[model samples]
Target: MATTTDPRIAVLSAMAYPPYNETSESRCTPWAEAVKLLADYRAAVLREAADRLDESETLRDLTDDHMHDVNAAANELRRMASEETRPSDG
Candidate 1:
């Protein structure tokens, strides 16, 4: 459900098609696909967070607790994404 115009998607697209890279066509295809997959996953996380906020009651008494939970989820997602995309030394 991610739109092409999304800034994250735009950044991914730019990364996938870098200028002056001399890699083979076949190799580039898989890399591009992986970037797209990651972008889609990030979008899904954002959507889920929005949905949870939307479903919460306006007069709920657990605002602080809910905010902490949401912040934790966002931090975890950011950590996971960074770890997954980082290049391995071995």
Candidate 2:
């Protein structure tokens, strides 16, 4: 089973696969590439978070504002990835 922290990467990997008995659209490559990039970035950010917590003397004492900032950054990355993969209504 995939860990919750990395589930998005797993989902993207699964979705990047070719469909059975059907041709894929040309635009799929860009979306797949974007997903892969986001997955890599997410993993890197998580690694950094773990490293920070490990090196900090008082992780338990982190302020709510700092936590919120971290969460917001992660959410922003998700939003950007979603935007890149979404089709525009043009």
Candidate 3:
């Protein structure tokens, strides 16, 4: 289990990968690295989404909003990924 984890990482693990949040694996994997991996994955997904949008002309109507949401998610994930894995005060 994670005895001293950043809450953001804990919540992310709980929501995206419960096993990490509940098992000793949390200690085995560094939160900063895990979050960075997730952020990178999100960037790849966003790129895929963009390519799909570019290939489908009919979906133009929602392309802007769709990209906005994806970009927002990517930015937020990046912010979280860059945070301290362990609180300095704790």
Per-candidate TM equals 0.36, 0.34, 0.36
Which parts of model 2 are misplaced by more than 4 Å? 1-29, 60-90
Between 2 and 3, whose TM-score is larger?
3
lDDT winner: 1
Off by over 4 Å in 3: 1-27, 60-90
Please give, for residues 1-90, the per-residue lDDT of candidate 1 as tens digits: 233755466556656664443565332435565565565566566655655654566524567888777667656665665565555443
Candidate with the larger lDDT of 1 and 3: 1
- Poorest 10 consecutive residues by lDDT, candidate 1: 20-29
CA shift at 33, candidate 2, in angstroms?
Answer: 0.6
Error of 1 at 54 (Å): 12
Instruction: Evaluate model 1: give its lDDT.
Output: 0.57
Lowest-lDDT window of 10 residues in candidate 2?
Answer: 18-27
10 residues in a row with least lDDT, candidate 3: 81-90
User: lDDT scores for all predictions?
Assistant: 0.57, 0.54, 0.51
By lDDT rank, best first, the candidates go 1, 2, 3
Residue 30: error of model 3 in Å? 0.7
